[model samples]
Target chain A: MPKKEVLLEINHLKAYFPVKRKSMKEEKKVVKAVDDISLEIYRGETLGIVGESGSGKSTFGRTILKLVEPTEGEILYKGQQIQHLKGSNLQKYRNQMQMIFQDPFASLNPRMRIGAIIEEPMALQLTLTKEQRKKRVKELLQKVGLAEDAMHKYLHEFSGGQRQRIGIARALAINPEFIIADEPVSALDVSVQSQVLNLLMDLQDEFQLTYLFISHDLSVVKHISDRVAVLYLGRIVEIGTKKELYANPLHPYTQALLSAIPVVNFDEPKQAIPLQGELPSPMNPPVGCVFHTRCPFVMGKCHQVRPTMQEMNEHQRVACFLYDK
Target chain B: MEPINTQQVLLEVSNLKIQFQLKNGKQAKVVDDVSFSIHKGETVALVGESGSGKSITSLAIMRLLPIPPGEITAGTIHFNGNNLLDYKNKEMSHIRGNDISMVFQEPMTSLDPVFTIGNQLMESIRRHRKVSKKEAREKAIHLLQEVGIANADKMIAEYPHQLSGGMRQRVMIAIAMANNPQLLIADEPTTALDVTVQAQILNLMMKMKKEHRSAILFITHDMSVVAETADRVMVMYAGQIVEEAPVRELFLNPQHPYTTALLKTMPSLDTDVERLPSIPGIVPPAYALPDGCRFAPRCQFAMEQCQTLQPEVLTVNEAHKVRCHLFSGKEERAYAEEGSLT
Candidate 1:
């Protein structure tokens, strides 16, 4: 919760993908996918990001890793700003930070053997010898619940769940203190999801790692995160400790999103405050509070102006006209 | 069948078995010993993961299974009193998309791109009912308006590609309801759309169900959709009905471990837990399924005997039935805490 203890601080992160016109002569249209969002990942803590498909949760994760370059923003990693840091400096930052992608099948190269996939990062970035990297790869395989013989197999040889484990092993190969896991379990089957989750948790404990876990699956995020940030159309609508946010959500968008999630309990019917309208295109986002159009509690001020995140009830921050008072 | 107030039994599919001719020259039984009935004005959600044979079961009812690879090996799909499987192509023309219509997962691909919405709508109406082209166009516009498509007549003139994904799905629903089918088979109707768009489709379906007196056979992998619309639920696993009960009863008191695990895997929007609870192991390949219990290898409560002997569907209560050794009391051994298959 303290800024001093923050391992990664993302300040005003912006990612805009250029839309190329039919003619090469025409100027490209910039789509502001991730628009000026700021958040911090603390030491040994999981900061959860929840949003619908195009809410820029993935873009936020990718932006931090420099997989997709941020148009603007300062990515401060351990007190030093990593954004715009190029060549050797960027390479160094990548070594300190690593990511586990959503689709493990696509992330892991099919032609590469599991051992090579895991060792590839170490080979390029680290000063470790061949024997050392191999030894490290074996250790990572064991850590993620894969057998030593699994190393010799190609990426396609394993199931969805197993391929995800290989991905975890590869992410850990760089020995990063900070990891960005982007919907790591979404592509997996329900049964296999828990195994990979448990493995990640175990690895976190052993390594004392901090995680920026971005997922639309809130329940999964709640199981592992210390704090959570709720995103709506490229902006943080609500953020607080898991208990505070879930127990008392302030933003209308957060409330609606939460209501959509179906709990297993059937004894009590959920008061679903269903959201209004569809998600606006990021290419042309609405003015004022991005969620104001859908918010049931919208006020005159909500339409006219954006609501800054106001601090409420010990560490909770919410952006909404209802909370403006 | 329960006592019908306004709800009538529209679609009654009994003892359905579908088989596909395998490349190995063997017949692979996909839909085996499946039976469920839907009321004329109720939503019966068929829920399962991939390869649970739900899609195939829906296809079999429509008599739409591809012949060479897929054949309705056995069973009867009785809509009203007529067995649909026995109906000739000419006879089925009266029912397919007229009496019983289907909505697939991807609406974009399913909808004819080259054909204008006007032609598609008019064709369906003319096939079943003897109506003038003008009357059919008017009916098509009316149907489109009912499904909440904006400026119906203008939109009908445009092709499916001209419409957004959400609007395209609305057209699919309009086509499905053009003749007011007694049974609607929606196989992952909202799966392809984003959450916001998915919500709209769901709302539209729920709205349409209210306006039209028809049974909805909603098939989806998402448990949330089931919780939203289903009056009753039929949970399938490995081509078997693991459990079947009233919607509320099934959720509150799930007798099967599979059902419980499924419930756990779904992350509640309200419960801000750190990690999602999940079951371990993937669905066994169809060819490699255990002779005794298909779910035995992945089941946490699996016992030594479960590997060799199939458990019968034993009634836990009047409202619940489960196919597991734990419920059957055939295997008394507790699930070892640390040795969970996951």
Candidate 2:
């Protein structure tokens, strides 16, 4: 096989938000939303980021998109460091990258018509005339399976599924190369969810789009992602090809997360390794191994020392002592 | 598990119709001709999408539906052989917390933020039982511990906001199980929690139910959860029960076109498919429902007869039932042929 092109890369990315202290005597604390994460996104493959709430999945996506300024580290887009880019340089990068939010109900502007909503991104980035932009908007609407006349209606006039299609159309307005969809279909019904997922996959092929699909749903992530990353408290615990990761997860966190998913099968008995307690607060994550507090296979070394990412196989990498040896 | 006594029926709802009066002087039939019965110690799942009337049906059984806009337009709800619909407000109030309890989806909103966990738990215990405050507090602590909350004593003093999402759900389960109600109505209880937390909560709920041998009206849209927790499954689409069968049977040989599409649509954990087979079009709004079958607009096998006439529930076997015109007559052969094609 030929070598796959790398579209984006990040090295030791960190995003920290300082918490408000109630008193002068209190020590200042920072919520380590995305802490020292490094990963590479291939040109047209979907890299899924799966984590529970507060696991910093959303923050990681935002930091990569430059929506949230990273506190530290480098972001390389197509072999060029774009993290520190400013003004027109940064604006140029934004045109090639777009985002589709989780909640369609809240993401789109209720006051604006569907056409205006889809065309807003183009108006900002593309140098197109009014007629040209209008034609493109209608074309994009039809591409997402929405009617051309749908542009005349407001956001409220559409159903949840239709609103999501509009969201997709808006994201595709500028023909982005990389799209970060944060739980795009989590809000839709099971029936409608498939429709959106199919449309996304179809669009990705047509546009040669690289997707950073972030969702808590393992089933969804498994369906669309070529490669998957498991995030635990702002850190990537495991990264591997979908088949390798799902079939043989090495990290304890990754294994627990995978087994916890309720399968729709009755022939096989459920083997959910129930983790004790909730995800710890990011403001004060555990020392050393962040997942040690709830890990089923915690060792003395795991409590005192953090494990760095180690390659387990050509397609799989894990950050756990179990695989380090 | 002890064998469920089929003779011991805990709750039976027959031809239950619920309507919401729209602002435009129109009434939308949110739940129409829905009928089912829950046997003692059995978990009957009510599965549906957002507007499929699953939640509304559960709320109606609890007698929690609002009055001005919402009303039980027709049918009857009988609990423990007594007609709950005929009971007065005050009389129904007695049965609310003691006989039948509910665990809502959003733990953060369902819990009172101002009140401490102990205060809330004891309030339910005290309301249903004749107990002293100190005794109620002890029982509350025990209930919390029963739901797998460590340091229950300390947890009781904490407010709802002080607890995490998973912890708050544990507290919610404790309150719901305080009285050991014969029938427990959990409406998407674990939907708000994380997958790990969801697994924990599901195990806890099953454990509690086993101890009490209570009937559960488990309501959720998640197919995996339905497969894991429910004993029997009822698939609802647009205010009607389209299919009913045992959990395994429902999953293996779903009869209704809607049920078949729903099962195929969900991305399964055990199997990998090239692309999910999705149903086209959206569920019709309740107010503007189609003339005949509710699912006809989206059903691929929708016959001309299905558009003009509504299909009644047909018994496929003793364990399975389906509501579709395809199973009516000669079309049954067509249904089987189409089924093999998929």
Error of 2 at B279 (Å): 0.5
Clash pairs detected, candidate 2: none
Residue A103, candidate 1: C-alpha displacement in angstroms: 2.0
Worst 10 residues of 1 chain A by lDDT: A258-267
Most accurate candidate by lDDT: 2
Supply candidate 1's per-residue lDDT for A303: 73
lDDT of 2 by residue, A196-273 (tens): 999999999999999999999999999999999999999999999999999999998888988988888777786778
Give fnat, all candidates: 0.46, 0.89
**Local accuracy of candidate 2 as per-residue lDDT tens digits, B1-342:** 667686698899999999999999888999999999999989999999999999999889989998869999899999989999999999998998888999999999999999999999999999989999999999999999899888989988999999898889889888988998999999999998899999999999999999877889999999999999999999999999999999999998888989888988999777898888999999888999999999998988888988989999999999799999989898998778766326
Q: Provide per-model DockQ scores.
A: 0.39, 0.87
Best by TM-score: 2
Worst 10 residues of 2 chain A by lDDT: A265-274
lDDT of 1 at A83: 81
If you score just chain A, what TM-score does every candidate get? 0.95, 0.98
DockQ class, candidate 2: high
Per-residue lDDT of candidate 1, residues A1-325 (tens digit): 3453978888888899888789988876777889888887789988999998789999988988899988998989888988878999889888877899989888888998899999999999759999999999999899888899999999877888899999999999988999999999888766677778878888888999999999887777877788999988888889999888888888788777777665555567767777665677887777887876777877777777988877887769987778656
